[model samples]
Target: MTVHVLEPACDWRAADVADETRWTLELSPADIAELEAALACAKARAADLLDVTRDDFPLPSLAPRLVEIEAQLIDGCGFARIRGLPVERYSDDDAALIYWGIGMHLGKPWPQNKHGHLLGDVTDHGKSGADSTSRGYELGGVALPYHSDGSDLVGLMCLRKAMSGGISTVANALAIHNELVRTRPDLAALLYEPQPYDYRGEEPKGGEPFYSMPVFTEHAGRLFVRYIRPYIEASQRHPDAPRLHPKAREAFDLVDAVCADPAFNVYMDLEPGDMQFVNNYHVLHARTAYEDWPERNRKRHLKRLWLETARLTDRPEKFRNFSSHWAQKRTKSELKLDA
Candidate 1:
């Protein structure tokens, strides 16, 4: 197998971005005012959350900045956080509206789950981590391994934080891939082949329980990755799924090790009202196990959005979401568990 060294704009290490200010954008007072006005406008129109569009929630002063953020997501660092949203002043519904509006300006909303949820909640649903049907975002108090989602970008808005832990970590998958090419081209080449991924019980009726896609794909000189360690491991449960080659297993372990290394990843402790966005193709994101607060209102909760970015015009057929069945039912996921 022939492997080539390819470098992209997002191939930076942790040391290269040691300054938090480089990736963190703090909302200005003027920006906050614009957001408030937009929230009020949307509320006055009595627009449903799904019905709200970018024009309905105008951010005249902040829209240009969001355009820059969109570019950064596709062409630069591949991850960013916007801080200083005074969540204490707004109700939960109002805060969600603000997040939805901001997401509209960035990209078109994509359904996150099989339920066709354009909007989603990231909170504990009393799901057991050991359950094969459980998704990482549906459970709490467990570390989520680094993996890419099924979209051009993934956004999360923090409504509340955990009592302890739950730090968000993002690693540069481009850097990891390039490193593999340089050090172990054999493993890297192996990853470019098709690997089976379990659907976690969400496969369409009578459809295969597992689907196959390459872990690494290069198109138009850009690298794209889709990796879910648990899903890959769980695919073994389906006897018909392709068996993992021994070298493929070694390659998967190396990817995980590189992501966990301090030199390759950066950790962020998000506060209430902070928003984070990552390029799903270039970055692998994860969360640490967290302890929730005793009070029901204080438990960790985040609103999620999967976005189809306009900047990314083309993709490998395998990366495109071909699950039309997901669109058959459109509803938001608002599951909550008793504290």
Candidate 2:
């Protein structure tokens, strides 16, 4: 396969964003008022969080800003942070509505897991990272390696901050890919080959426990990435899964090494009411291990959304069908909120 190279539209480095101002968009008082009014309108109409639509939660003043944020995710920096919501003034339910409503303006909600939850809770659920079937979001107090998620865009709205640590970091995968091609074309080529990934016990009935997808894909002149090392490593537990090639292992290591470099990553501590949105194809994100309050009510919690953006027109065929089977067969039980 030929190595595809393109102009750096979204390529950025840590030094490019030395201050939080680069990625942050603090909402104005009018913006907050508009959002609150929208929420009030939705509540008056008896709209459930799951049932609320962009039309239902109209953001007249804030809609333009949301548009700009979406553009930044697709074309500028691959990530954007919107802060300054009065999270303390609202109940958990109301805050969730505001978040969900804002997300609706960005993109259509995509299911996060096999349960087909368009909206997901990101709090510790007493899961062990050592377990082959455990997903990173299910485990608490563990640092996550930089990796892309299974969506065009992924968003997290922080409802509560951790007691300590849990700082969020993002690395520019686009820049890393370009650097790899310039420095190590051999290693970069291997990333285009299919790699086995574990389904994390969410495999469809009668389907293989593992699926194959390339770490990097080039389609219609755009670079798309989907990397999750833990899932790839976990695939080894399945007897039928293909063994990882030695070259593929080297490629994985190289990608991780590049991502871990301080020059490539930007770290930020998410405060309550801060909403972060990232382009899954261009940015790889991680979080430092955190300590949560012992009291359940005081624990760190963030709401998550996987989105399919309108801006991203063409993608690899595998991505469209990435989790289509499970999504089609999803039941009401899978849509229920676990938290």
Candidate 3:
């Protein structure tokens, strides 16, 4: 099978983004004051985060900057770090309010997982990565393999840092695609074919326990990739799931090898108050194993949001309006913030 080979606008190497100045946006003191003021107003009105709108938490000064960020996420490097939120001064609830408010300007919050959780907690929930039903975010102290989230964009706001390790890494999948096309076009072609993926126990009721999606797709002159090696391997447990093709396995390995190379990955030790946003289609993210503080208050924690951006005019049919999980919509539920 042959695939169209086009130069992706998001193609970028780690060296190209090594300078923090390119992707890091440090909020000014005024920006912090504005955010705090909005948080205060929202608190005063007892506004629920799910109900809060951009108009409710206005960012007169930061709104334009967010628009710029939206552009950068789509047309530029596909990932960014917004630093300086003074998270230490506020409680986790307050910090989440601020993060959710900021996220409002970027895009509409989509549900994370089968649960209709517009807001998600990224702290470890005692899950094991080795378990077929375990989600990486729910498993603590384990290194997450590079993978894309099911959303147009994914954002994480750091509330606490781990005692050690847990550095976040992002790789430019567009660059990986370009490299594969240049070096192993045959393997790259295999990626465009559908591959089986385990649903991780979130399978639709009365439906198959697995689903099929291509690792790479090109739509309207754009490159889109959805890769999760662990899930693909786990699908083998289901007797009814189609077996993975050997060529597809080779393609997965090639992509994994390219993503692991330092030449393609940008590593960042996310600190308290750091907010990171990545275009899920163009970037693959991972986290290193970490040791957490014994104290619950000091344990590593981050709030996450999966957003559907208005910037993309077109996307693969499976991704449109969260169609991939349409059959499982009845199971939608939101995760509550820990007290």
Best by TM-score: 1
* Candidate 1 lDDT (Cα, 0 to 1): 0.89
lDDT of each: 0.89, 0.85, 0.86
Question: What ranking emerges by lDDT with the best candidate at the front?
Answer: 1, 3, 2
Model 1: per-residue Cα lDDT over 80-189, one tens digit each: 99999998788777888999999999998887778899899898878997899999888988989999998889999999999999999999999999999999999999
Cα RMSD to the true fold for all candidates: 1.6, 2.2, 2.1
| Predicted model with the maximum lDDT | 1
**Candidate 3 on 1-339: residue-level lDDT in tens?**
776555466788888888998898899999999999999887776656677877888899999999999999988999999999999898788889999899989998786776657788888787877777888778788889999988899999998889999999999998998888889989888888888999999877788999999889988888888898899999999998889888888888888889999999999999999999999888999999999898877888888988888898788787765565642432212333335
TM per prediction? 0.96, 0.95, 0.95
What would the TM-score be for candidate 1 when compared with the true structure? 0.96
Question: Which regions of candidate 1 deviate over 4 angstroms?
Answer: 321-323, 336-339
